[model samples]
Target chain A: MISTFIRHELKAFWRSKNTGKSIAVRIVMIFLILYLFGCILLAGIGMDKILEIAFPNDDLVKSFCGIVLIYFLFDLFMRLQLQELPTLRVQPYLHLPIKRNTLVGYLAITAVFSMFNLWPFLLFLPFIFKIIAPDSGIIVALAFVVAIIGISVFNNYLALYLKRKSNLNGWIFLITAAVLILIVIADFWWHFYSLHNISYAFFGRLLTMPILAIIPALLGIVMYYFNFLYLKQNLYLETLTARKVKIYKSNTDIPFLSRFGTIGDLAANEIKLVFRNKRSRSSLIIGLFFMFYGLIFYTNKSLGQGWYLFAGMYMTGAFVVNYGQFMFGWQASHFDGILVSKINFSDFVKAKYLLFTTVSAISFVLTIPYVYFGWHVLLVHFVMCVWNIGVTTTIVLFFANRNFKRIDLSKSGTMNWEGVGASQLLLTLPLILTPYIIYTPFAVFKHPDIGLALLAVTGFIAILTRNYWIKQLEADYYSKRYRIAEGFRNK
Target chain B: MIEIKNLKKIYGNVTVVDIPHLSIAKGESVGLVGNNGAGKTTLFRMILDLILPESGEITSNGEIVAGHEHWKAYTASYLDEGFLIEYLTPEEYLYFIGGLHQQSRAQVDETLTALGDFFNGEILNRGKYIRDLSKGNQCKVGVASCLLQNPQLLMLDEPFANIDPSTQFRLKNMLKDANKSKGVTTIVSSHDLNHITDVCDRILLMEKGVIIKDIATSSSTLSELEDYFGVGQTVGATPVVKIDEEENH
Candidate 1:
């Protein structure tokens, strides 16, 4: 009966339009990741021919397996955040002859088969086959993959159940904070000790005999049962109701630019929309954290150089485009009224660009602390801020004008293809390459500053041409208002 | 005056609304009535240019709805609390809309005074975000926000839905004053025919994406609406009784 419920969910997924889209997206992601991994593996093999690290062969393999498992854990955590489970569907199933345990059990089982489970294997299998096949230990790779996938399944279900439980108890953020702390601790230990190679160490132990793979595999099975128990106990409406109320309350408290008068009011409203709305808020938070990502590459003597400026700008600006690219469509749910209101569509677009610029400015200011060690770093931050405000904001707003799907902020980041479309991709192409493709030639030749100047100028022009962009946004809003509204009305 | 001519809307090969022509004179209190999917909301949205009709045009005071030209100076709509920025407290939302129309904060306060009872005692002072309010309270805030603007044209979709009985009666009076006293052209959509019959100068009965009946409320007998909704006459038959059954504990 449990299997039947699982099959029923599978059937429903197969029938859903969104599920079809999800599957297509998953398949594409799988192939893309696999192709990328294949290329990387080939590169690694080529690199191995040129240079080999002195670490033992088994150590490398175990390291490879450990990396695969770590990626799976991160992927599972992200999947939980991005694709909040459709617990609403359970409402109907509850009334059916189906027992709750059967439904939940099936859900957990189905979770194991998610694409998050597939990609790690794609990356791991090729590396194992390339390196370990000669050792006659291919089964270690296969068994490790299975165990990692099982643990990932366990993690996904546990995270979802915990989220559901938190939703009921208004402790979602608290639970998430706890989980994040644990993951951070794990990451800290892993990074400090270079323990990514631990799996290779374990696999080396297992290589002599295939039966040793059973150890981790059996542990994975135990964790899966624990997940099953958690889901079974908390599968009720009462818990979910608690979560809903808490979510509703938190939504009200999200900070915004409330002090700026009417424009401030508007900005505050946009801030609330970005924060209170589940999907957009996650992107915002991700963007906020991503501000520090530039520091990863720009450090010490390498900092303040042309490459650092461009790379830092590109990295940070990528976030501006990433989070701001969806802009108005994030409000597609009520975009009709917003479109028709006395507010100018240009002002609306301007407001978004302004907000993105504001965030970029804040990010640039934050980077100033990093700049103190090298005052020249401020030059990079200055140029990047201009590029982000000028080029990135315009590009983001341009595609944002074209985006029609009303993304459910709560459900965003969970599913693979939640808010993606052709325009969004096309928007990204220019954003990624423009800094390099257009400016690199100048920089590579005699004048690096000229390239930087060009970036700033282009971005400046984009920013200065606010009226033109506004007109364009208004036209787009008029043309697509109904389509946008219809998209939002879907769910 | 507002004019809608040959308005048609299609969703995935299915036409949801196709109206040949419709017009409401200045100061006309028009009530839109329809079944659940009967294109009433769609029509109101069209008038506000919230949704564009595939083929046809809507004009208000001689300006097309597509551009901001006419709508710039005159038009206000509250289809739902979605139009209300949910994070705002009721006071903030009211002031925000008031500020949009250049209403002084004092005027905003004075206007809320007229509709004060709609919110129970000091609901605005409750410090609860409008989003955190119960459905009934949310609707009251929305209604108050829309009315606060005092624009020439007002569009409210199911304004009275979720509003308590006392508040509903007060909103009706407010609508009546906005029309009769201020000469505001008001188009309101509701499933409750009697409430509309009591206030609207013109009543349109919509069925399945078409206006089956467009009768002046002053000309048509109350029995006509009763018959249309498939209900027998009472002293102003309450269509909301069905809604009340669900709203009441």
Candidate 2:
């Protein structure tokens, strides 16, 4: 029965339009990663004779393993992040002859075969095989893959069980933050202080001796069973019940925004949409985490103080362009009524642009302490603000047309990979590259300030061209409304 | 007023709805009755302009239904929970929908004033999100939202399906009051024959994507209506109504 259920589930998954595309993307990504890692491994092995460059030692391998562990945890958590099964649609099956345990077990096991699990092992197997074996290379590589896959599966089930046991927002946030902090600290300790070196050396000795390879494989089995137990214990549907959803008071009472006339109401709605929708709200929080990435790049660099400003601007300004691109389309599922309503699409775009500006401005304000490194940081922040609002907004609006996937707002706060398509990939290239593209000519001419000025000008144009772009959007919307409607229904 | 001409909706090769020249007058209380897959909901969606018909045009108030700004101002619907933003607490959604219709918070409060008995006040002051509410309570919130908007054209598909008996009674009366007193045009589609029989001024009997019987409530007896439904005929002095079974066009 369990096997049959699993077969049925896999068949359903394979038949799904979104799932099939996602699987194809994952396969391509794995191939690319394996190719890149293969180059690194070959370089390590071949360089021994050419340059006598010391091969990465057990310490580096152990460091790599620790970082990989952190990556695996994030991946696993992401897979089970929201842990919302498409159970409602399958509710009728509950009354069928199929047992609950069989259905639940199938789901728990299928969770192990996630896109996150396969790529890491595929990427790392060749490198580990090079380090460990020559004659029995396949066996050693198999052992490493088994162990990592087991660890990832364990984390996957553990995250799912946690989500099943408690759907409390505050608790989930606290636990995720705690896990992230611990992983970061452990990674730093292992890398700089060499805490894991001796342990890996011992493991390496055992591996050469042929006994430790057996141990990892055995440990992998144990972790797998441990995760299986966790899932089995928490499979009850009622266990996943969340606390009542909370309604927040509208913040339209704020001055300035309230005084901005009709634009104010649209701005307030945009903020409410972000707050009221789980997916948008989650991105906002994740954006906050990304803002600190600049701190690491800037503080650790001995490069001139000017570089700090640039790095900081890039980090903080990243969120606006990245997330703001989805804009009005995120509300596309039920957007027909909104479109037909008295509200203007121009106002919708303006409100979104304003929201991006507000968020980026807030991020800039928070980065002032980091500017203690130099006042050039403020210049970077100013430039980033302009680039995000002006240049990034135009690009985002252009690409927003390509993204038609209707995100399920209910499941958005968790690690949902829904609505990601080839279009999103196309959207990312220009977002990441356009600033450099626009700034390069000025850089080549040895007038870096001119590049910044151009970025500012581009942003200013986007802000001013709001209606022009909205008109273009209006024309595009009429033409593609049927297709967009089709995409939403298919998902 | 809404007009649907040659409205055909096909899911792949299956034609779910294939109506020709159906016009609903303003301020008319109409009930749509059909079995599952009878295309009642599909026709309602076309009139509401939620889904476009493949080979038809729909117009509301002399304007193309597709382009009318504030079409939603005159039209409010709750076919299912899809129209409700589940993440919001009932109060928030209620207020939000009300604001969309340019209604004040006080107006919404006045509209919801009678819901205290129906909901036991748990929905409003209880700090609970609408998604967390029970199925019955959620339906109540859906009904309350539509009522708060006070739209001219109200489309409800199976509103009583998940609602409690008490709320159902309140809804029946409220709908009747809206039609009679406020002149609000309502189009209610339900599988429950009694709901349409008891409330609608004009009940439309739909079968296989076409209206088979368009009988005024006052002109038909309950048994004759049942016979028209093809359940069975009854022997009585009640007049028999003609049901057009061959309107292929």
Candidate 3:
């Protein structure tokens, strides 16, 4: 029965509707996976040398053991962002005559085949075989390898369980991310404790007392059994899936927006859309994370200060770029209704412009504390704000029409590459390059102030011609409305 | 109120919708009965100006519908789930549609109060988005949205398919009352001949992208449509042979 279940999974991968149609995308993904595998292999082979460079005085094996817990902690964090649960694969088998245990066991075991489970072996196995085995007995070496695998499995299942719980209740995800952030802050900024010594003390014993490896193995088994029971009980179709959100009552009225009449109504709808969907809402949350990104660059002050422009642009315009790039797609679920509704196309486009301008302005106000770095940083940010509102916003909205991939609103955005398309990947070129084109000439002449002036001037032009750009975009959209509608309908 | 002249929409070589010429009167309740893929939806899409036709035009009230905004003022259509926003609550969606038709929120609330029985208390203020609602409840929302707009021309596709039996009866009576009082020209396509026959005054039976039977509904319209549909075959329903049997009647 397990074999049949695995076979069904294999067939599902091969016959997925989206694959085999985009050969170029398939080739690109394969190369990306291969590149990741190559990096892991090189890291595995060079582990001892890396340890020697980082900690020259300590024993290589000791240093490695010291970092095992740290490695597992980082692994859990990465898995939280990258891993996906194959929870729905069991839906097809639920009605069959097979025992429920068989299906649950199949999902738990098959989940271990993830690249997260394998990348560690490619990273640490070489050091274990070369350094640990020759010095200690082979049994001790085997115990070390067993301990590493055990911890990897434990992290894998634990992350999956937390993520599963988070899917059921969104607050769980927020709380888990908050706790992880707090831990990092406490350990790094407070310097009140050291995770390094704690890990060394725990794993350092496994080398001398091979029997101590049983602890990690026991942890792995406990986590696996916990996941098994959870999956067994919740494998029912309705339970594994998310239901309607009924937790908090939110006001449906936006008094300020309602005053704008139809465009205001559309903007209010767009706001509700961003807050309601898992994928789009995650983008909103992630955009907030970038508001703090300037600290990484502003404090350094050594990267030639050109980076401040890029960072400032991102800090103020990330949401505009991220959300506006998928502008029409956010409404792809109901493009048919929009096409037939009484609302004018230009009014819809005007609503989008208003949304982008409003978000960019709000993000700028929220980042005012960044001016403490230098008034220069604030000046660059102000210019970029105008540029984003005037130029980048239009560029992303134009690309939105070319994107045909319909995003399923219920699915989370992290590691789920559902709505990504070639248009989005290509959109960044104009956004990044145009400002440089306007900026580089004056900077070459030792008067970089001239470059900022030119960019601002061009942005001023764009801002002044907002109505014209909107009309042009509206005309372009009118020509392709049917095709866009068809693309969305097929999905 | 609606006219389709020399309309032709072909998918590759297959003629999906090929109506030579047809006109629906201003107050006519027309039922479009056909097998699956017999161009019922394709025709409705053209009438709504959602899809472009290849060789002809659809004019809503003498104005060419394609690329025109004037027709939408009085035309409200709910062809499928595609017509719904799906992310808003039922009340929110109704107000949005009402806003499009320039109806005040208070007026919309009054209209929704009238539809409270048809909604069956599962839609409005249910704290669920339309996408999360059950198929039956979603249908109630979609149909109720059409009624709230006070549109002169309203279109609904398969209004009886997913609705509960009790709601279906309520819907039939509501549609009948709305048409009788407002004289709204409605275009509805349905597979259930009984419900549509009870509601629509004129029935157009299409087969292989052609209107094979156009008859005013009477006592025997359901039996005639059933004979055309045959038993146990919905998609493969062939109505060409029923023309001769109909002529004999």
Top DockQ prediction, candidate number: 3
| Model 2 chain A: worst 10 consecutive residues (lDDT sum) | A47-56
Worst 10 residues of 3 chain B by lDDT: B234-243
Query: In candidate 2, how many Å is residue A47 off?
Result: 14
Cα distance off (Å), candidate 1, residue B56:
4.8
Counted clashes in each candidate structure: 15, 1, 0
Task: Provide the DockQ value for model 3.
Answer: 0.53
Over 4 Å off in model 2, which ranges? Answer: A20-234, A240-266, A272-278, A289-316, A327-329, A336-342, A369-377, A412-417, A430-438, B3-20, B54-56, B219-221, B231-249
What's the best-to-worst order under lDDT?
Answer: 3, 1, 2
For model 2, what is the C-alpha lDDT against the true structure? Answer: 0.66
Candidate 1 C-alpha lDDT tens digits along A163-189: 666566656757776776576576576
lDDT of 2 at A433: 74
Q: Which model is ahead, 1 or 2, in terms of DockQ?
A: 1
TM-scores for the candidates: 0.78, 0.78, 0.91
Docking class of 3: medium
Question: What stretches of model 3 exceed 4 Å from their correct place?
Answer: A1-4, A14-20, A34-58, A77-82, A163-195, A242-251, A300-302, B231-249
Which 10 residues in a row give candidate 1 chain B its minimum summed lDDT?
B233-242
Better of 1 and 3 by TM-score: 3
Q: How much lDDT does each candidate structure score?
A: 0.69, 0.66, 0.84
Model 2 residue-pair collision total? 1
